[model samples]
Target chain A: MAKENKTNINRRQFLKSTAIAAASMAAIGAGVTYIQKYKRDENNAQELLRPPGAIDEDAFLYACIKCGLCVQICPVHAIKFAGINEDLAYGTPYINAREQACDFSCDSIQCAETCPTAALYFIQFKEAGLKAIEAVQQQGPEALKNINPFEVQVVAMKKVTHIGVAKLNEKTCLAVKGKGFSGTPRGENFNGVLRPQSIKNQDGSKIRKAYPLKEQKYEREICDLCVTECPIGEEAITLKKTTNPDGSVSYKPNVLEGCTGCGVCEMICPTEPASIVIEAGKTYEEVYS
Target chain B: MSLFSKKREPLPPKKNDEMPHSKLGMPYKEWMGMNEDRHKWRNRRWAFLVFINLLFVISFALDLSLLEGSLSGSRLLGFYLLDPYNSFQLLAISIKTEYLPYLTMNFVIGFFTIVIFYSIMGGRSFCSWVCPYHFLAEWAEKLHDYLVKKKKIKEHSFQRGLRYVFWAGFILLAFFTQRLVFETLNPVGILSRAMIYGPGLILLWVLVIIAFEIVYSKRFWCRYVCPIGATWSIIGNISPVAVKFELDKCGHCRKCQDVCLVPHELWFVTRGKATNEKHYVGSDCTRCGYCVDVCPGDALNFTVKGLDKIL
Candidate 1:
């Protein structure tokens, strides 16, 4: 009878400890699940513009360690780490194009090159650059005179760099409204900077340097900042002119396949809410399909 | 309800303070002032933490490329230095082959380099000596102690074992979500990134945690949670280097326990508790050497596995 009593107590003790263990494990599992769901929901609410050469969004999240190597290497200080409220994207490098778009001033896509984890994979850009050199070399001296191999390489690199696609809101566009813009695009107090396209120095050598947007002035009969300020030039964006029924020609900025969605157009837009915006993680096909 | 309903109180004093001196005639408070005045190891540890974090800032600001990344991953003189915990999280999420190439050779080498380094030096040394967040948390702990001493707030604690649960939970979380979920809210990575890349909105979250530590709990993040520390503790288990406790030299004053960051590791420091004359401090000790500095009788000191026998 005593032995039976001892066995009963042992079983009860075992059951109690096991129940406690199971309860704690369940609580932890539930907490982690809740956090995952909350983070995913928060992340889904908005999309972020990743640095140039960033892999697919889902893979980028898994691979990036949030080391900030890309952030440190960016010469323009364009790449910034996402804040906590960014949900699953927190600590990841992103470009807030409105504050300061990636001007590609480094010409090397230095941020992507320096990425320790290849979260901003650079192989495609490298391949693009190599292919440009090969195409120029294949055409021999004739192409060499017309095309500076370096310029071709830079353009080739830019061609493959797609962080997002730029979308135009014709309803809010100053160009579509047939209004002229004078003075700075973003106003006198704006701190955003951009490197003007290749300018010749005194010795006839081209030099590119970034200048604060507030210091530069523009006089456009019809606002063309989206078209003019585009880093990828006419291939990416162009001013489309159409003849009206009244025989008057009106112009609208057209976004084309060559657009890298680098967000410079969005930054320089004079509209309250940018008339042209980068649809992050989007392709030209998806936007137009 | 029971967890929240418990009455808040300052932790009771550890042991009675009847005798100022131990049987060996070594005094407690004397060592306190002396150690504080010439705390060489503590000063060196502080300098190391400051230097490492500053290197990241300098490398970026000057374009030196000396130490080019945050604690999550970095390049030290062009050699990869990836954090093992971050690598594990990466592996957990990358079970599918589509993103398999992301785990390049550089990352694998970096990961093993850290693991090998920690296995030799003892793992938690990184927490005390290198981690930027650990440095901040240590200061916060000092402020917490002061607040508790003044009765401004009560010290609340949870089971230290909870950290292990969190460590496992994080990896499991990655497996389930196919994302490095912990990286989103990891305070260690956030603090490091903030130091190098400037402040982010998530710094507010880190501030909330520090405030909670100061007012509600004492070293809550480092003690009860922190999967990073939990990861280190596992690596620290087979470490050859550790704090060696000399049983006979112990005074039973409990000053060492009071000063220890993780006191449970010093359990055998009590009189008549230890089976051996010399016992290595447990893997969770962090090798901070606070107990060594506070020990009036010189009971605990750092030792390497076979080095002591030869010397």
Candidate 2:
């Protein structure tokens, strides 16, 4: 009888630990299932205005280690790491252009260069970089390329690929009303970066000094800051003339494919929410969805 | 010399023990009873812990916010400090990086390799020896002691049953959100970022969790909430390298029990209640060697399996 009792106790102990191990596995399985059940479908994919060289939405999620390297590398301090509240976007880097725009002040696109995983590919901005490199390599520094080999790189970067498309809300546009802006675009207290009017030196080189929007004023009869001051210049946007119902000719800004969605136009628009907004992702398709 | 490695010491063989205490070809050190080698081993482990934590904290900080070109990733020298929660989240959520030329799959391979190695080495060894949060948690416990000295408070309220509950809940949350949801609550993550970018939301969470620990519970996160701890416990259940108790040598002093982080683990392991014929032995031991260091009778020593004769 005592021998049987010893076997029984050993059997019970065996069962107890086995149950615990099985329970741990079961718990993990259930938790994974619960998450899979409620996980957002692909339709919920955020059409984020990712930093310049990011890959596809689904691929980006898997590959990004959330190391925040790109965020630290942006010269304009435009990139921000998504916080926990961003949900699936958490730990990824993004640009909230209204708050800060990637001005490409660092002409080499340093963020892409710094990405260890290459999640932000330098190739997206490569056409311009390649063109500039070729121009300098093939044509000597003294050769007059239509665009300065250096400027061509940055300006062409604003042309080839885009973060998103800029859309103008006609009803709220100041130019639609034939009204122009005067004084700082964001007003006296704004903290956004403002380029001191680009001026051509006697040597034919352009020099740009920066002043905060709160400190500078651009007075105009037609609101053309979005077109004229655009880093992409005439390539990204142009002021088109139109006649209003009152027989006054007004200029409406037409955003071309060259408008690389820098959001500088949006920031300097002088409108409260800015009439032109950059809808994130290439083309406007499926952005809202 | 490696700040992250633990030097294995051979336990003194019992008079009639079957297995050889030292593996073949190893030079055996004399087991001079209760000597400085014992104390030096414990002190070295502590110093190694501090060295590892400070080394990473500096490099992680400099590489993160200060440096131009830096060595990157959470892995170095084949050691991965990843918590299981983060690794599992990376898999379940299907996270990918945008625009990068290479695959983020490198992390996946490293994460799994570390998990397998940890399971073999006796799990939670990382937690006790290498985790930056371990020392912080210990300091928090010290603060709790100081607080209790001035007032009246119970030591710890560890409920073992609730461990898997929070563990699974975090995993489910990671899955549902398709994000590393628990990183917000991870003190290690919080501290690393705090060291780099200065104080922010995650640091605030760290302060709150540590303060919550000092006032309300002891080692509460590791005991009741860490999913990684739960995963390690499951994988490490049969690790050959574990703390073995020579029951006959024990004096019933209870010193080992007082220093153990896990509740009643020392009691059951020492009393042979957790280890009997047909039952596997380890009880979520961190292998921190605290109980081994504190044992007055030289009874508790880390050893490989086949020591069930004590039962």
Candidate 3:
């Protein structure tokens, strides 16, 4: 009878311990997942400006390993990893255009090339680059004399790269305010670098050299940095003279379908807090419409 | 008794009490003074941790082709290296056929390289030797021990098996959410990335986990919640490198068990308890060498499955 009692106590103790462990595990697991679900909802709502060649935002979030390879390979130093507060997007690379923009001066989308996972799907740009080269090849040797195949390939690659669309805030725009401000767009303290349109690379291969904004000076009758400094040029954005309600001519920057939302316009804007900003992950149709 | 009140035990003489005071009459000792004998394995582990993690920082700063990228994924001299746990989470999230193409051959090679390397080194060696978070947690554990010894707090513990449940939970979380859900809050990845890319707000999460270890339980995250450790523990099952025990050499002092990170693995080392003359530590053992370090009789030792005979 005593032996039976001892066995019963041992079994009871084992059951009790197991029950506690099971209960605790269940509680902790459910708690963590619950918090994660809440954070994930908040995370998905964030529309971040991703690196060039990034896929659709939802799919990109799923596919990105948060490796930061894109951040390392970006020659312009445009990409930065998202903070923990970004939740699901934490450690994922994003371009803060105001800080630095993808100038595409590398003539190669190195970030996309280095991406092990096709989170930044390079094949789209790769196909576009191939098509540009193929078109030049088809045009015979005469086309090659006038046209730089490498430059055309890079431009075509840039066209396919839609990270976001630039939206203009007309109220804060210096051009709309009818102001002709001079000196550097950003002050002498600004550290942002860009491959200026006037400066050509010594190599003449169309891979432009980047210079700090502090070192470059700009004199304009009206602020047209967004238009003049655009890497994609006239196809992406244009400054147009529009007649206002007072019958006064006001210059406005017009965004077109060719806008890659590479965010050069947003980065170069002289106005504090930026007069123009990229609506991250928005397509040309979505922004214009 | 009140709900929060506890029975206070009388304090014993601390190690600091016996040590001579400084010239200024302040209590002084070696920084993080552990009175125990010089731990060779622990020193080697700290060195490896510092060197490996430093390469990640140096490579990025100098733009060296060696060991680029953080722990999540890296290129060692243009060769890919991926954290197996993080890679597995990616696999779970992108399990669909269409997504398979996105996961390139480089990822496969990186994953296998990490697996093979860890397996050869005895799997959980990564936890003790290479994981920066593990090193931090060890410091937190020392603080925890000090608190416990000083009678300031009691040691709170949980079933170590909870980690296996967490391991499965993370994979399922990835599958259901279609995201690397844990990476957002993973301390291991956060610490590793912080070293390479400077600290971010995510480091707050790591701080909270460490605080939990110190105040609530000793090594809470590592012992009960780390999916990375759990994943390696599974790989450790097949690992040939193990902590071998000789029954005759054991003094029955049980000091090894006292120092073991996972004490359950060394349960058979008790006096007259082990069935075999020689027994190998269980898969759950981190093979951290704490047991070997603390063993006065030199009973416990690191031994490769077949290498001991040749040596």
Candidate 4:
């Protein structure tokens, strides 16, 4: 009886050990299978011919560090970051110039210049070739074909609208307070103010004197923050020429397209409180219009 | 004469007393017997794991076409399998000058897959089972072992710290130059590009590493210099899955430590002790489970941490 019990115990132990070994082996086998599947898929995918214009497919695959500089600096904002698409090649980086084509004419090669990873090469304006122009023309027709030109859709137009113009209140105007058109010596507290009709240039290059006239000439140039501070390349507020009654030409301010509705111009206006304001309006029309 | 009668004539009942304890340390037989059952379990796990890895390699090769410019059905399958949108552009930038937008989806997916897998199993699954780089490195190390007589290299704490510094420098360089210098040097990239563009100096450099692996050590490059490995390691921390060691059950045999390709410093970290003055192990681990297979104690097991647990 004792011998039989001992034999039975040994057999049970052996079977249990074998079972454990088999189980572990199976688990490891499954894991290895998964890895093999993943590698095979990855390898097979790598062999396909890259899309047209792909330079070094392998380097680009590893080198691209996703930074949004190209998208930010694109003049037409044509570049957009790609999202996950399983059917497509590994979603790394690609240009979609169908919407807003690459405007190579922009002064700064900001996209390439600002890219944190030389994922984008910086090409000089001349070197960028005819592709830049072709891209723009292609985009123009494509964009127009998609929708109504005057429609107020977000995708169709730049999203800034002019609100209002800067106004100088005479009572608070620096020139009315005897503080000169340029305001304080430090130029910090420059309320919109006109200079006295006759004043000496700060430098002694021209000799002149101030005269207290009965009526002040409102100098349009006194407050140029709106014209100078706009983020758009061409300032939103631009100086336009107008003929006066005396047959002399004078300059007046005009707002141009491409304003981003970022109120830097209004914020920087040199009034006690800002004189320039972006009031809500339709199509950025004039206050009287 | 009858069999029973003969035995009776010689019979003095045999003494059945237990043997007295000898003070010359525990007997080897008893010590080994006590651990034999546990060791069997471990050895079995190890063998099974290796077999699985072999299967995976076979499957991958069967499915993928490594040849260049071959428009096989597998190539189409590869395209559908690995989305190449951004990867194509990145490769272009690496070879020539071109501007393309950077997209994060692929990186995020690759990162998340490793993290998710690590959380489900222990770290070794990735190294032993999934990572192609680990396989390459291991093959290299095996060659090294064969040629150099299986000598071990001692990894100091400072060497681990240097990896972090190297990764930081890579990031800074990319920030300044807007180029992935590290990726340019990556062996995988070199191989793939060479296959596509034909062999060049870059391919020659990668070939040297392969030679080194065959003769010197397995995974020498991955342990020492892979930036992608470093990236995965940092991300792997949040992985809820890890190998849990039962210290009480461990026999102090150090078998698990021996098979581990990652530095031993990591095991020290997993045990809740700081190794090399760092709180966490450096990111060289691919979580391959070789260590679990070699353990004699059956001390290691995979476990999940709660959501509140810090990765």
Candidate 5:
């Protein structure tokens, strides 16, 4: 009986040992197959180059935690999430503002300021978008006017696009004939005026109401908000001198790049009816053809 | 067949003149043995790992300093990484201009180098001798063993399945979050942050978890949680180094299994039977050699699997 029991134990031990060896072999085989099939392919090289406007592609890619702060704070909604190919290069947090160009006139460097990581540096006023505008302005108005507003010709107009509209209420028209207020009021004279134009409201209503005297008093002289803030360069609203056939000079307003869809002009318009109101659409007109 | 024949033949009397002496001072064999003993205690492997960790910490600090401009060298390194002008020489060669390449490369290289080195020498040497995180886990396990004094809770098959399910869920979370959550749970990271950030509520909570692990479980982090360990285990299966057992010498005492921190219960499952169990050591083994020391029959031994066959 003891001999039989000992033989049974020996057989059991052999079977157990064989089973363990087989399982280990299977596990090793599986591991080998996984490594062979799933190892990272290092040959793909398309995403290596630094994207446009990135100061340092390598630094930004490594440091960016992909918090999406820049995307949230963009006032113009100019910045957009990068696509897969771009993501591979930029790692998770990357922005492309080409679709909607940046407006240099905004008061805040919202994107840079809100970036949790220093992926985008907090540039000073002179170093940020404002500097790009100043540089172009220094080159003379003719040079500025000659620029292709739609093309990101200047850095200031990085991703600008028409996002809204500016409409006026005819009832609020203070300068129309037979209105309560006509022409520029006292102390309201045009000087460094970049653009002057008839404005419309968001619903395409013409404002005909009497323009508030106090507001108009400042609007004529310092109201470069529309022209300066327009993402496009040709000054969406321009002041023009209408010459009569008899050589008489009369002042009139004109819309050049229609109105850069950005509603900055509407936001800053001072009038109650908002001489300019931004609505969703491509309001900027084609300048090239 | 006579076991006492060798002993019976040794009839020489002790001669003080015949005793070998070292000219310097101590006997050569005694001195050499003493030195070897000291080296064994010092454990050069552990020291190497600590040195690597320190190097990494120093490099990280230097990178931070570069941004402040307090250190020119660091600033230069930053510039090299973050070329603001988009006109760096290194950028020309790199496939991706993004900084992510550098970070990913660092992790991949570190992991593979250690794995390859340990696999060549013995199974999972990094875990046993060098990993800072493993050291922390081991310490915690000791504390847990001392405080809890609990018997092994035999895990049900269903409970074992739950671990894999949780692991899958965590992997999905990591994919979506784009953050290695397992890495975040690393005790090393916890300890480092606690030391640096200090006295915060979160740090306190982490400490509580550590205390709990110290009291209730043996290698709680390693057995169930550590994704790095999971990854290593998967990779280590193909490792050529392993422990072997001599079938003739094993006494079936089960002493080796008792000493093993990892539940060797599954070993039987793999082996197909309980009694015939062989030492199926591979990459999963941390090369701690605890089993080898605990084996009463002296049957267990470390061997280079593929190389021994080749020789």
Candidate 6:
């Protein structure tokens, strides 16, 4: 009996140790296989919106060090780390447009500026978006004078389509519903803003003044906050007048070619979930793939 | 065969009381100044980790944008964001979402270069020596040691294997979900966000971790759970450097295992007896040198295996 007890103790230790070792090996193998198979799938990431000036979704995934630096330095605190449920974008910085938009409150994109690697690609903004880059290569910051400074800086440094275009959900939009709004979109307590554009007056003289979107009162027979409150202004979103079934005219928010997707419209939209949503990391391609 | 070799006689001195001053206990004249060098590599590791974490925290806290173009405000001075998991996440997500080629020079550098660095370092020296969360965990360990005073303590052995499961599950889930799911639970990201943005649900997660570490865990998070440590440990298994044992010099004091985060690995390596070649070289061994420092026998030292010949 004593001899059998000794043998049993040794056997138990052996079994326990082997089981742990085997589990570890199995886990490692499965992990490697999972990563390998995922790599082969082309449509694994159907949608992801990286911060502006990010190179590519795949490159951004590995390039970002997950330091949370970008999330830290945003002047408006627009940037946030992706939550655990967000798959591979976890720990990486991204913007949730409806909650808060990248107002460029830092004058330029601060998140991209502070990224250590080319993950955020400071080079993307060094030239600005492609057009701004082309403009600089052709004329210089002087040629970019007539355009919005923020637009010039961003476009000169990166792709215009770096983020997605904002599409308005017509059925719910205040303007599309033919409902006129008279007060602040979010209420007096809110702190949202409308970036005053370099607008041309009657004599074509430009007037630019930025004010809190919540402080500004709107009184249109058809609400145009989606257009008026858009930080990118007409360059990104526009109000298109259309005839309703009652023969009454209403306006639909149209995303234009110049939409750089700063996502201000999505933030200031009066709708609960926001009538406009930025389909992050998309182009005119329009499909998820 | 067992993690605890045997009960140690007397008690080890706490770190605070090790130093004495005139107003405090020993006179200044008798002190002959302070012998600050308690553990060479161990203290150095502590200092380096503190420096790294401080730099990371400060960089995350500062706003260089206001000082743009100024030397003090230079945007270049940000944290390395050098967590290995970032590259791992990229590798997993890139494969699942797109083809492998979507990876770039940056991804290649972060992924391959860092892995090579870990492989050469033997095991995860970074976890004990550089990871931001480690400094806090060490303090928690010290606190637990103080709190667990005379009571018999037992480790939840099952949780030891959970880290392996976590490491594997994280990668597999990343592939299946094509999300950087591990990033959400990343202590660095969570803590950094908490510090920079003010405490919220992220900090709540931190509180949960603190409760686990201080109350129930023996540094279980790092020893078994972290995927980053798991990755480094695997890569570091064949690491050229390790904490070697001098069996001839050993007094069988078992102080080394008492201070070690992963004592089982040390026990495994030093099963029959401690020696240079077969000494503790576990992958998850963070090379923190707690074992080396506390070893009353002076049997352990960080060494480059084969290079022991030159010495």
Reference-based TM-score of each model: 0.81, 0.60, 0.83, 0.37, 0.38, 0.63
- DockQ, per model, reads 0.30, 0.12, 0.28, 0.03, 0.03, 0.13
RMSD over all Cα atoms, model 4:
24.9
Q: Please give the TM-score that candidate 3 achieves against the real structure.
A: 0.83
Q: How would the candidate models be sorted by DockQ, starting from the highest?
A: 1, 3, 6, 2, 5, 4
Docking class of 4: incorrect
lDDT of 3 by residue, A68-141 (tens): 77777677788888775654456778887888998887788988877777788888888999999998989999
iRMSD (1 decimal) for each model? 4.1, 7.3, 3.6, 18.2, 15.1, 8.8
Tens digit per residue, CA lDDT, model 4, A35-93: 42454356442212221122343344445443333443343433443332221122233
In candidate 2 chain A, what residue range of length 10 has the lowest lDDT sum?
A36-45
Compare candidates 5 and 6 on DockQ and give the better one. 6
Candidate number with greatest DockQ: 1
- What fraction of the native alpha-carbon contacts across the interface, defined at 8 angstroms, is recovered by model 6? 0.10
Which regions of candidate 5 are displaced past 4 Å?
A1-289, B1-51, B54-125, B148-163, B192-202, B265-279
Q: How do the candidates score on chain B by TM-score?
A: 0.87, 0.72, 0.85, 0.56, 0.57, 0.74
Which of 1 and 6 is the better model by TM-score?
1
Write one digit per residue (lDDT tens) for candidate 5, span A1-289: 9999987887776555445534543453344333322421332222122222333433544344333334444444444443323324212333222123334323344455444334554433225356666667788888789764322233343333233334433344332211232333322432112122244456875333323223443334433444443534355665455667998655423455545444435433434544544433323442223
> What DockQ does candidate 5 have relative to the true complex?
0.03
- Model 2 per-residue lDDT at B309: 52
lDDT of 4 by residue, B105-174 (tens): 3333433443564545533344445343455666666666556564454222223333444555555444
Candidate 6 local lDDT, A1-289, one digit each (tens): 9999987886776567546755654564456446524642543432335677777665565456566556767667677766544433445677777667776566566677666555676654654455554656587667667666565665444334356777777778988787877766677777655454433457875334445666666666777766875555576678888777998776788887667677777777777768877777667457222
By the DockQ metric, which is better: model 2 or model 4?
A: 2
Candidate 1 lDDT over residue span A129-195, tens digit each: 9999998899988878988888889989988999888888999999898998988888888888988
Largest lDDT belongs to which candidate?
1
For each of the candidates, the C-alpha root-mean-square deviation to the true structure, in angstroms, is 7.3, 9.4, 9.2, 24.9, 17.9, 9.4
Instruction: Please give, for residues B235-282, the per-residue lDDT of candidate 2 as tens digits.
Output: 666676777666545444466666677636664433324332122226
Q: Candidate 4, which segments miss by more than 4 Å at Cα?
A: A1-289, B1-125, B146-158, B191-203, B213-219, B266-284, B306-311
